[model samples]
Target: MLLTAPDETQVIAREPWIPRRAAVCLLICFCLTWFYTLGARTLVPSDEGRYAEIAREMAATGDFLTPHLNGIKYFGKPPLQAWATALVFSVFGLGEWQARLWTGLCGLAGIAMVYLAGSRLYGKGTGVTAALVLGSSFFWAGAAHVASYDMGLSAMLTCALCAMLIAQRPAASPRARRNWMLGYWAAMALAVLTKGLAGVVLPGMVLVLYTLVSRDWRTWRRLHIAPGLALFLAIAAPWFVLVSLANPEFPAFFFIREHVGRFTSDVHSREAPWHYFLPLLIVGITPWFGVLAQSLRHGVRVRAAGFDPGRFLVVWAVAIFVFFSLSNAKLPAYILPMFPALALLVARYLDSASPRATIVAAAPVALLGAAALVVLWFAPAWIDNAPASTPVRRGQVYWITGAAVLLALGGAAAAWLARRARTWALTVLAAAGFLAGQALMLGHESLGRDKAGVAYLAAIRSEITPQTPIYAVGQYEYALPFYLGRTLTMVHRAEDAMLLDLERRPHLWIARLDTFVATWEAQRARGIKAIAFVRPDIHADLQRRGVPMRVIGQDARRVIVTNDVTAQRP
Candidate 1:
């Protein structure tokens, strides 16, 4: 049953593949899964715990102007996300879901913007498919559920991208163009506040690339630059002005060292190879890899006339990819802004693709699913000999098994329906991709629990009062401060302590282990209650040195100890 490609013109005019009611139902289900899973797992460290704690501190201290983590001033990024999350905490009360609410909303907003842009740029079908694709994308979905700066930044950039597309369309009225262009500028400002200059820089780079590639110089006339720049400055300037007035050192550190130094040098110790994001991008779009290849190929063919949006989107995605790839410091989520553009491109390709092409796309998904099942089958035997792996592996097996089954069955079903029911086939694949991503994230709680230190909260809380002094000696548990509703004093952790203004507040930072030991001895002599969270190896060394401490709780990562023997649990 060989099938030939249909005429491109005819395919463009065909009716939408999905019915209206079904689209609505699918959207409802997606929303349920998205928000329902926000609190299903503990907040993981590095990004999740860091951002959440910043918000928690902001709310607790009522100092929204300057962000702080573990009681020291933190100026690594702008305060927009922390401000939003702190507001959520003020109204909703503190919890995992409350901390993550803002990020979830940002993710939802990005999907909505994509749907609107896709519908207007291509058609209703393309718009719907684009939203589905973005909402289900493994990286986008996972990042959205976690408390972080990336999703908020990505969502604002998506708004800017969509607003520009809407404003520049050939059929747009003068008033509509003016309004949407303002929206584009405002989104860019929020994006700057969300992360930094990359918000505006990345988009500005795309515009330059798009103009050069598409030769659409006249498109600039529709941007309403005077008012757009005014709006942008109005929104993004005040914070910089206020923060700089309060802290003289902010301008240099934020602009010069944080942004420029980070990109040009490896000061942050996060340097990676140029190809670091390649694997991330590949896995980021899971089942959609086949469609992505098709879309990029389709995007290269220029239309004969007016605004070449396809070319613009291609440049938008490629330029951002190249920009970050060249940077000295790289993280997985640095390329998140590219996902929305890729979704739009993939949506356009799927709209006009033949059934045979759709079936081909399903093949990889099915194969990947089978491979996952095979790995899961032997996982137990492989980890059986390792004592530490047993609990975590056993807890995760059910989730991995369920995800593999969903992907396997969904791919097969989509392939079976492609010949006669194109919409249903794509919808099934998107749903499976979404659910599988959620399952994997939920399963990560097994490991996240250990890192988060939430299990030790009970014992630690029972021993301490609000006035008790807590010190993180030789290590910092990123998640513990938020759970405890207080910050820990830094001891011998120079990397984070270096960010503070040590000239005025030298006591806040402990630069040497001997200094920490002396302080502990003095506090114990004064009969002042103090607690310390120390790494296991450091705890053993301190114990061997005859430091007066009693263990209240112990975990593989850290040991919670107190100076008073009565506080220790039997």
Candidate 2:
């Protein structure tokens, strides 16, 4: 199948840029880089550590119905990803790569789906290009390597979007269309299970917008809504129903607070201005930002006779972008679901674009790379007083410098080759972008080590026994629990409602500094050994209060201490 536009189809047929063998080699290399790098870095905090720990706990306790983090009931998001990760952990022992395997596979699947969809909708060349574009796109590639809900959610949403497009194509047989529509519905169900309502809401919104924009009201007739809805509910409803039944508080918290409150208000303290995603979208697209701009512009103007897949794809990208932009809560990954559509659009645009346009597209990437180099050169001086150690800062600079150089040289080479060898030009740029992104990610391990508390792991293990009570005072190290394979006693009241119920789990929480001190004293009096991870300022305060503790490990962010003075210091 070819693009609906005759001219675009001709361009694709005339210029099959890259050789088939080379494309296969590039993809094989990508898969190696993608999977091999999963264990290359420590899991960073907030999302990576949180999700991995939840899955670890789930696997350990054999509680798949409800998710828990740090041994506390957590309903912040759905459990599909956690369930998958937990299953992985159950089969393979817990580790960095094992934790990220599910997300990585989802990311790989998204690339394959984009390739298939682009191939069917546009042409074989367009499909191959789209896969390269998505597999190397900085944000898409980076998010896949991290253990998070966004990749899983985005992958399913991409599946739904691609299935719908394929199903609604003018050339699809009735049986083929029905099967694809059912797949679309099932993908949406899995998407809803991956995140929350946005999984369903985003796609539903895109459908409405696409129908309105294309004036293709008849599109709804082909959706097989009755059977599709039945399939969707059959797949998505069981977990929500069972979990809500098991935990009475699940309904309001998961539906109302997490979905509605997170979107409509700044309750999560993640609010950003309306134009927040604009810069992210630009940078996240990386070397392809120029192509994206061209794609959107061309996609809007292109018209087709029957069902317009390009128009639908454009609407899908725009609706999702606008939906999240208007939201009170903003995150870099929140807009990820729109990327696959953008990839298809960009692939279509590249298929028809002149060599001169391709060269023009390569210019901005080169310029951005140069600009990044300049920023990195002066960044150290600008942040001379920053808390990070000089060696850490130097290492980060080196890694970024390598990435910038790759971008700069690759972009220039792609521009030089665009007219003579379009296929090679695309391959060079994609390889650079992919490697640069991996470099940036691997470089972060320098800083992620501290954030992940990996440096203190040996000290922590040596000082504490399996049954030793570990308390988190004033601050919680999200990644440490996952590393240590144990949960910490949260001394402070957790900000998340799911952390603990103060009324019911009063014994589990030490609400005040004084209370923690008293508890420490009582434990010491009973000849019990206890370990606590305390913030530096909190540690100083405890020292002033005459608390008896031996410092076992120390870092700028945290101080690990034990009540047993005989414990060896690190």
Candidate 3:
């Protein structure tokens, strides 16, 4: 075996065995990789949480077509994700977990889709390697855990491109050609549903670029226009037509504002430089990142071999990469669709690629270990001051620091394994990284970021009778209402719908931002119980106004502040 743990990537031009052992290993790794995202359960309404809320709202309101955000008709994103979440909610009943179930499933589907594309088009060995690289990829992994639209978008994009690449060929039969074109149409439709026009455009452009660079327009013969269009419309048209009809302005905003304006501006607030994805790609797809680099370097050397599998994949990867790289606004996820292309190229290169290059590349694995130890060593100083008030135990940071050390060891071990032609060791390194990172998230960081707010909301539920009107001062955590089984009104800087609700009811709870309240010092004085989800000083500052709110529960970024009603002479 010419495989090593650090570079277990297989040959891209042939088929490999579907080894049972490898299958089991991949299952376990992916299973553990996304092991616990609190089952997409209640915590806080992140961007993802908010989207889920919109879907639930739609289902409840019987407004199946139009997408709503914060109970308002929002036409920013397409209705695919919301619709998907709504379907799950309708079937399983709405909850945090149910709302995110479909997206989470999509994440898993993407991993499997990429693996199939790599294995079938390239080789089985390459397929497994690609799957490992993708699963361990930071952005991909993070997307899987969160309820954001990116995961679903990535899944669709990968499928669309992979479906097209695998099916596109010069001497394809009629059936194969029909299938490919149909795939193009179906994938394009799903992509549109997932994230609107760019889904189709990005993949379509990449395919066009690959074919043009390869000088192989003959593959266009496979496009069965009638059937393809039919399939596309069947999957995607109903929602678009209904939603557009429901809200007449959807087309203009969705296409023009979301696709065109987003590309040209930083309205989504994910703006980055022209080269943002360049470094982001490298760092986000770590360990195997060296694999993508080596693959590209090898690709440049063999560029003259026109129409070769390697060239086609490289062109596909580089074209997509450069396309997003040149864009004014970029996000780490903008490069996701490029991963499969890179993986395919790497798989091909690994078939006859140099051993020394891979081994030498594995050297960086050591740096990860050093980084972990450094962070762990000064964790007390570096770890966010967890408002938990429990003295920072060394045990708490142990998991992340330990995992860091383990990945570093993997780098060294992978180097040795590569020397011995043990490519599968690469799988081990990825598994270690995945386990470490995921464990740390669930075990520690998630406590503060994912659950603290939910916990704060949960604690005061008893105090919040049915009559209690809840107000979210800054933003609503979609998961909060779902978890608490109640909805909360949102209040901005000014007195709005939320304040009116408070005036109308007795048991009123407000998710007040400390600074916003401090600015409106009058409100801070009236607030009997302050649930501070911020710095200690903010709460301490409030004491100066004669409002004594005690912290009942604490996490890294959130604190539940409640005042003693008995002490107050009302």
| TM per prediction | 0.96, 0.96, 0.79
Steric clash pairs (candidate 2): none
lDDT per residue as tens, model 2, 157-222: 999989998898877899999999999999999999999888899889989988888799999999
**lDDT at 304, model 2:** 69
Candidate 1 C-alpha lDDT tens digits along 1-570: 322322212226655667779778877888888999998889888778888999999998999888888777788889999999999999998888988888999999999999998888778788888987898889999889999899999999999988998888776789999999999999999999999998899889999899988789998888899999999999999999999999888898899988999899998888999999999998898778877877887866635246766778888889989999999999899999999999988888888667877787677888889899999898888778766758888889889888898888888888898887888888998898899999999989989988888888998898789999999888777898888898888788744424556545778778788988999889988989899999899899998999999888787889989998655455
Model 1 residue 171 distance off true place after TM-score fit, in angstroms: 1.2
lDDT of each: 0.86, 0.87, 0.62
Model 2 deviation from the true structure expressed as Cα RMSD, one decimal place: 2.4
What is the TM-score of candidate 1? 0.96
Pairing residues by index, what is the TM-score of model 2? Answer: 0.96
